[model samples]
Target chain A: MKKMNNRSDVAVKYLLISKDGNALMEIGEKSAGIEKQIKIDGYDIETIVGFPNIEKKEQIVDGIAKIIELLKNGEKIFNDDVLIEYVDMIINEKSIDEILYFTLKHIISSNLAEKTAFFILNDKLLKLRGVVYLKRDNEDIIFENRAIKSCQIDLSNRGKIADAMFFDKVVTVNYSELPGKNIERYFDKNTIIIPVYNIKGVVGVVLLEDDGTKAKDDASLRLVSRLVSLGINYSSITKQLKLSKEDVAYFKESIEVSSTLTHMGKITASVAHEIKNPLVSIGGFAKRLERYVSDERGLSYLKIIQSETTRLEQIVNDILTYSKIFNIKREKVSLYSLLMDLEEFFKDELMIKRIMVKINCPEDLIAYIDPRKFKQIFVNLIKNSIQSIENDGEITIDVERVKNGINIIIRDTGDGFPIEIIQRPFEPFVTTKEAGTGLGLSICHKIVSAHQGQIWLDNYDDGAMVKIFIPSEGEV
Target chain B: MKVKKILIVDDEPNVARLYEDYLKDYGFEVKSINNPHEATNEFYMFQPDLVLLDVNMPDKDGLTVLRELKKVSPNVPVYLLTAHDEYKRNFNALYAEEYILKSRDPKIIVNLIEKIKE
Candidate 1:
């Protein structure tokens, strides 16, 4: 057996003996005499292998021919049908992680590497999640190492690797010349890192390390890049599936609630009709009785009937007012104008109840809202407050602009809502008052949500406060 | 002027009778129908100068009847009777002469009818 001295010299000698043997001989003229001297020094002639002087030339030629034949057979075997069958096996696998594990194992086996790992990118922290080794005996492949540090290297200056991966592409660190960071904490001693990217963005990385020099070859890097891209595409498809499931759930809930509202609307309309006809008859008869009746008892009874009929009318009005849903007609409305209109409409009621109403809104303060809907919202709030307070209680309406939005607060000297009612005051059929329809605050909530605003009730020590926050027009 | 004969169409007999008696006191010859199905024939036969139509009926909705009345006599003024205030906007869209809330005192309706007669 002949021993080879110095691997580099062996590689050079093999290259010189190849197709460019004559050119290499001219370059080796200076060392020609040294080769002659080595022959005289009793070096074994059979051990002295050169690129051009091959002892087993015929065997090498035969091996190459066989490899070519095998390649052609492999191509025929993987014709479209076979290729599709292989792809279906990978795609139908229960988990993508299992497919990735097998793929990493295959790469390490084919490349004859010491170790290989696949790290999936964590979107939340922009970091690696797990490491899958190919043949290495490291059982803790998926363990998170917090001590690992990363250093960003600018490859733009290096022309060879400049456009290899785009600017956003992650490059693997050469462990031998690792940059000034705790890079070794992430990978083995001799590893090559390659980024994984899908159409959307970079999703993961692949690391290959080995004792052999072939691990850093360009061909190996290119093969690993293609596999990473396939893995990233699979991950993105999974993410889209999750989002579609959530959307389906939300759509079902919306359909259920809308149907409930439609049924309620129909029932209310019919009941209102039944109640009104008899009410009109009673009012008409009461009016005629008042004209003919002279006794105090008879006159008082007629007055009672008239008052009761009026109360029933108010109840019907409230029901109708709360059930209607209107689209927003956004327009710039002055707070001063709204307050003035409300004050005029409620003036008589205020006088009769002896409630003192005060407005503290700014004259120039403006907000964009559906005027009709907002009018009803504010009126309901104010009326509820007035009804809660005792006779002579004070009510104040104030509007102010703050932090890119407008806040309208209505405060009244009334006993605050009970603790139980306060928690879910905006829910339908939740009322504190004897004559409450329980839909007042629910309607208010729906209106505020439609306007892209918020309405909340605050319980103060002395009174109750209702505050409305509406985002300013043109302001997100 | 034949007192500008008025027709009252409602599903409730008592409601129909109330309007008929009240409008008669105001010197108007009023015809009334409690069944909405019979409204189309009676409406044309009466040749009413104005019609008071109730919005909620068992056989047919008031809006359908309103459309039929408009086809029969587009020029004749029709007033819709809605018990609920929520229907006010919908009533406005019907292009009726006016909307009469049923919850209001019958005296208001009598006064409104007299004003419409003018």
Candidate 2:
């Protein structure tokens, strides 16, 4: 205003006009370290002449360097639209290794660090199960070491990797500063341990190593880690969904077969007694004639007649068993006691076949079921297993409690189910054996269904396996 | 003490004949009523020590016959012998002494009847 003679104030005005076209500025006083305004042409300017705050100058320089880094990062990210596109395109990649290698390669190419690695966690054991590492060298190459892949981060022994997982965030650590830290072995410089996580929690960790001076954008690194998490989670979800779909399809088919068998059962139940009465008469008459027939030929003929009638009787009984309907009278039955009774029941057959029966039931385990019907299932299953095994084999009945249900597994060291029969094992009149009415598995299916349980058959390498899962409390 | 006289009510003729033959062979006096409608009359006429009743019949169900027979001779033990076991849960069947499946061998029935004392 009055022919200002301050050189620093004039320089401030020129700088503001050149940069922002605004001259309202404040500068610190050299002695007081307090800000004051200097007006020029209806505007103010900033002064730095004898300002004694050397800390302020260093702060400005640091601020400028950060801005420059931000601009450079922004440019790199713009060019990395391809990375975003690659992430979007490779999301459906079936093999996670391919995606991990591609991502590690891309990250290494970005020059964010001297080295990049992805450490995948084995969710079961909480250990590092795999690693995909990329490093800058004479030629760009991605490699993995079995030893590094097996590295287990001892969370108790806190380090950058453990902190990243425990805090559920990115952790930066100077490798040289950490004495006796496990993470130092992996990196020769600074490390940014970024956690890869999803709704299920931290599934993996990402290690970014660089010279201590290189700047890292934590937010961008987090975004990349998230993308990697999404890829892994997507593939796992896809596998589970595929298995669930197959299970649904299988149950749907089982239901259709059950409905058809129910109709046949209804028809069979109506006439079963009508057929059984005559069988009893014929068998009774054969027995009566057996006393008078003295000749061996006559006796043999009578035996044939008696045996055929008995066979007919058994067929009718089997059919009626299949058609029988009863409510699932659920009660808390001691499974250990029930299995023990079955072991006693088949004691003779088991001894005859020289089969070792192993009942792996926890004594305290109890299930809500219709005791009689439940017993019938085990009887039929055990008998089938005994018949399948010729001699000197093992039958294992393992029972365990699961989420909302009880699982019963019966494995027999015998010829597995014929492939054709395994497909429709629960269908009525389906049998792999000769002379049976083929209603055993059908009866088992019906009984399990009445309890709103699931029974499936599988063949192990050396034997047949029957798996049954029912709610702890019977659903029906 | 042995059961001297018994009655069997069943709709099936051959099944009744088989029971009759088997019971006769066991040396117990026995009567067979082929019709459930005529069961109460036969029960009253026979005044037997025990009655064997079938569950299913053409004109009248055996549970109703069982109720009538119990009304006539409340003290006489009635055993339900039926091909179908569903009737064992019927309220009328509670009056019966035992529920035996008809599919059992006739000799088993004979042994069961012989175990009854009068």
Candidate 3:
């Protein structure tokens, strides 16, 4: 009898016990120079001498026992018919994680391989999607390792797994010849890499680290690959179906919102038109009576009436504007000249606040826009900045041309929006000022959206900041 | 320069009266018509140097009445007035002298008339 001193001796065979399972009858051994031979030949030995059985002393024992019993009855563990039935039962009812967990546990408990790992292939990138290993403490099976979950196998370099994926066939390489650090980290000697295929050809690969006893039959390994490929395909199809459903739901919602806006627009225009007639009457009479009034208090009352009516008229006009449909007229206009025009228009307001305006934009930077409509966005934002600043502050308009669009950032050196209003600044009727109609930002949002653009607000550096992105191509 | 007679046409009687009072105090001979159907008849009778025509009216479309007024007095400067600027785009092609938003102070009409380059 050999001394059982060599590492390969203990690795390939185990202690054979009597039927009573109380004593070891003999130490099993195999030919020493069989390294070059396929490990599949070892499966011919029917006795459980060299195989490791489930030793977990917990409720998990029943699951392991059932898998071992099925194998003992001469049923091939990788049989596609049996696996499809089992996979079908749990596939739809369980999450991908749970499915992977059950499949991995079945693989290990049936003694198909000592340890296994599943990799999801995306083109040349192999992501370590899931892994299963036996715990050394109680020999309980485990599914995922958080530390190794993000590990990726790049197929650019030559390795057994990459070779199997690229060649679309099975690859067997010794642990030392694994070709990459990540491959060497997860696998042991005599590791087999089998490519999993779908209708689209090879989609993934499985790494089986066998204990030198199981048959490495090509037919059985291919079947295992087919089974796993089915699971991957099912997961992907279900994910796409879920996304399609969500897209349909979103489409329905947008249609309903657009219809509601159209209805609201009609009502607002009619109401604004009706309110304007009364406003003209009240405002016109107030001015007429001011000339005939004598007392100082009477004069002040008349002034209030006139000013409040003007304010009411302004509110009505804003409502009409907000609900108005935008017929975008696209034009190629220089943004610099537009800002300069606004600065000139608001010269008096800017001067009164002692505000310094600095615009950082290319004089030649042109954007496709409706000049009249685009001007309204800047006018509202700049005016807000002016009103926010109490006295003597800087307002900066920084513009950059992006690949698909233009980016504009407006920053004001003033106290930012109040916290409550900042969260929903673009919503109608949200304002911090007492006299504000609160439709300013909403109108800006509407116009920017009409131009296939986006707008958002933030607070930083002791001021309020507004960022806007307008796509270069207008949706005319 | 005589009084630079101004004709005001609007559907609202009170609004028309208000403008008549303000423009009369500003030393302009102002006559207002509350009905659009009566506008062209008044324009011929009043023989005003300028016209302040409201865009929206109950009896008829102000743009149609504008065409009638232009036919008779093509040389006269007619300003389109409205509570909203929706009609601004149409005013230019119709050859109106200016577009006045009714939201403005009525005194603006006086100021615009005072600056007439007749």
**Comparing to the true complex, what docking class would candidate 1 get?**
incorrect
DockQ rank, highest first?
3, 2, 1
Error of 2 at B65 (Å): 3.1
Ranking by TM-score: 2, 1, 3
Score residue B59 of candidate 2 by CA lDDT.
73
For model 2 chain A, the run of ten residues with the poorest summed lDDT:
A10-19
Q: Can you write out model 3's per-residue Cα lDDT over A70-175, one digit (the tens) per residue?
A: 3434447654344534444333434555565556566677677777777666542333243433321258765555644554555544345654664567877676
By summed lDDT, which 10 consecutive residues of candidate 1 chain B come out lowest?
A: B85-94
In candidate 2, the second chain superimposes onto the true chain B with a TM-score of: 0.90
The two-chain DockQ for each candidate, comma-separated, is: 0.09, 0.10, 0.13
Question: Which ranges in model 1 have alpha carbons more than 4 Å from their true place?
Answer: A1-266, A289-295, A348-358, A391-393, A473-476, B2-4, B43-50, B61-78, B84-99, B105-118
Regions more than 4 Å wrong, model 3: A1-258, A474-476, B1-8, B26-31, B38-52, B66-80, B88-100, B104-118
DockQ score for model 3: 0.13
Residue-wise lDDT of candidate 2 within A1-476, one digit each (tens)?
Answer: 11122323211222111113432222223343324433333332333332234443333223322322433344343243444344333323346776776666767676677787787665434355447767778675656655566444443233455545645667777756433325455677777778876543467878788676566676567556755765665456445555776878987878656566557678887787688767777877777778788999999999999899888888888888777666778888899999999999889989988999999999998888888999999998888888889999999999999999999999999888888678888888877677788888888898999988999998997799999998756443
Candidate 1 structure quality by residue, lDDT tens digits, B1-118: 2237889999877777777887887788899998888888998788998889988776777766776786567678788876654455441123466788776656776666567557
Candidate 3 local lDDT, B7-38, one digit each (tens): 99998888888878888877878999888998
